[model samples]
Target: MSRFVDIRIDPAIVRRAARGDARAHEIIYRAFSAPVYSIGLRFTRVPAHAEDLTQETFVEVMRSIGSFRGEAPLGSWIRRIAISKALMLLRSAWQSRGQQLDEGWEDFTPQRGQDGNAAPDATIDLDSALAQLPPVGRTVVWLHDVEGFTHREIAALMGKTESFSKSQLSRAYQRLRPMLQVDEEELADSKTTAGTVLGSC
Candidate 1:
């Protein structure tokens, strides 16, 4: 008979990690790496930058562990760190490329349907849609949709007014709408062609 190992939740693990116990550090690192990595990827399109952000996130988490008072789950704490680090990396990259922070996307209002749902024919290849967005737009969409942050919260996180954050999100949707529509049409055409070929045979 095979034996099942029982896993336990221990506050001591966190404490030990804060105290620099290598084994405890490993345990914490493994537990939160995926969530951090996924969050980082949402912020950065490049794989190498995302991976580096993930590692840097963990380092920050480890360094701050001693100050954690257990107000929120460790996973959430780590995620916050990851988001902050990814944004920092993005800002640095933007500065290096000599891009101005003020993009005029705010003037572009998204066309919303009557029921307030995305258009039925609209489809977006998630990665491509996101990649085409400006940094502020991409961050707003990812933070709101993927990470489940409210516009108000996102505003606070990004150090922008709520109106600005809302604008950013709206512009992101507007920019993506056309691309999504095109994707849907292509998919429909492909499906129709495939069906016709099958029926003729």
Candidate 2:
């Protein structure tokens, strides 16, 4: 018998999907497609590869859903699948056809401090700057800042040292900060000017 599931039954849906329930499987797929795609892109940095990972990830997820114990959030479960898919692709590329990666993006260390508390207006939208980082640096920063993983966890996941994770975060910030050349004082001044103009008008 096929079981219909709402988002509330995420765990049940996962279980049933693992057992091949078509309806529950659809719910699971729709729930995690965007995050799987976005994270796949982050890992692979190729749009086409990301698309493939998204599909492959869902397939893997469905295959393994019954084993999911709900120990972590559903999203985390799906993310693990996506990361695994991307890494598998990387491995296959290396083994089958040999792949070359630029080494210049490595050996980066952040010149900035690790204190999360930068001054007011300190948080810069450095998405573009992040794109310029070496893929490893960007991955470290995204996993740390965006995904909220600890250095130890990231090191474990990437097979690097905690110090390497810290250094990558630093390098990513240094490369990013220059792109956000505006100072806190400048941002404050602009805000004040805008406020004054709006107040007068």
Candidate 3:
């Protein structure tokens, strides 16, 4: 009785799941949970939110898998739900908690370690640099670059113009380049300091 499903599924399996086949439901959930949670973590930056998003996505999946209609891959369908849920959470947090999406660069300065030494070299890694971006910038970067969402798709999802998505992604990259790359001026200054110290020795 379920609607036609995706290339990722057998119609009979969808039907059985829709008809209360517990094993079929389990199969679908297990198959899709990793991708769902992956996007959840990238968008929310919290493992707990990712875990919650995964559960919420599968809840909708189980409830509405009958109406899939084979429009795309079932994985894509599940991902759409997860993205919607993640954006909803972001919006809720921004509105209710007054979360700031455009924090100043000074505020994102890498923190010292517990022993008060500099942050580890890992701070220069892609993941850490991505985390330094403000929320809107970070979301656009991950959605467009990591998730392979098109500018048009991202704009539609965020209720903005395509140019907005493009600009946000641009700004995110502008912000990230400095974080991820070494600065020539800083390198030169450090070399100068090293030479002076060596001369003094």
Candidate 4:
């Protein structure tokens, strides 16, 4: 499991939510909506699809809240739900298009030192660069780096082999390296900002 910044939600609210209290549900939504939507957007890159995923995630959370044992923070639980829903949507989309999970690796072969045609600016926005990657490449990178899922976990989630996850992540880094050439300070700043924003929820 990924380690998230510890942001405490009152146990009483979770208890109320498990009991099907509508007001408690509303509170939970407000607390988690931003991070959930952000994850959806990162995965789908479509505002409408992200919206749908966010809504679906909350619905599932509400339905399953009674099983939550307070073993982890509420936000972490909600995040797992959001990731599952987003992956389901992606799988459905791929299947509808007759695309196999491992069908397109040839297209993603790294152009050695390719900069993704990034601008000459000294700094690049990580999120913007990520948005430009192929969907599978972007997803694997996000799951492994941002979400801290091990390659085995990511493989299980995507219904693929661990080697596939490793390869995809390698290709993703090859694609991303040139577009996001930040210094250590800049990298730390981005991580801090993301953590703060997500933790705020």
Number of the predicted model whose TM-score against the real structure is largest:
4
Provide the lowest-lDDT 10-residue window in model 3: 192-201
Work out candidate 3's RMSD over C-alphas.
11.0
Error of 2 at 172 (Å): 1.1
lDDT of 1 by residue, 62-100 (tens): 899999887866666777788788877876777787764
- Return the lDDT, model 1, position 166: 81
State TM-scores per candidate: 0.73, 0.69, 0.75, 0.80
Most lDDT-accurate candidate: 4
What residue pairs clash in candidate 2, if any at all? Answer: 110-170, 110-171
lDDT of 4 by residue, 87-133 (tens): 89988887888987655555554332345555654233556566666
- Give the per-residue lDDT digits (tens) of candidate 2, residues 58-147: 878877777888886777767766766775665466446444322435444333435543333334444544555666666666666655
C-alpha lDDT of all candidate models, in order:
0.66, 0.61, 0.68, 0.73
lDDT tens per residue, model 3, 1-201: 011122276768888988879999998887778777877887788999999999998999999988888767777787888888888888777767555444334455544567665445632355666676666777876666545578999888877789988888766655554554445443223233222322122
Query: Which regions of candidate 4 are displaced past 4 Å?
Result: 1-5, 104-117, 181-201
Select the stronger candidate by TM-score from 3 and 4.
Answer: 4
- TM-score, cand. 3: 0.75
lDDT of 4: 0.73
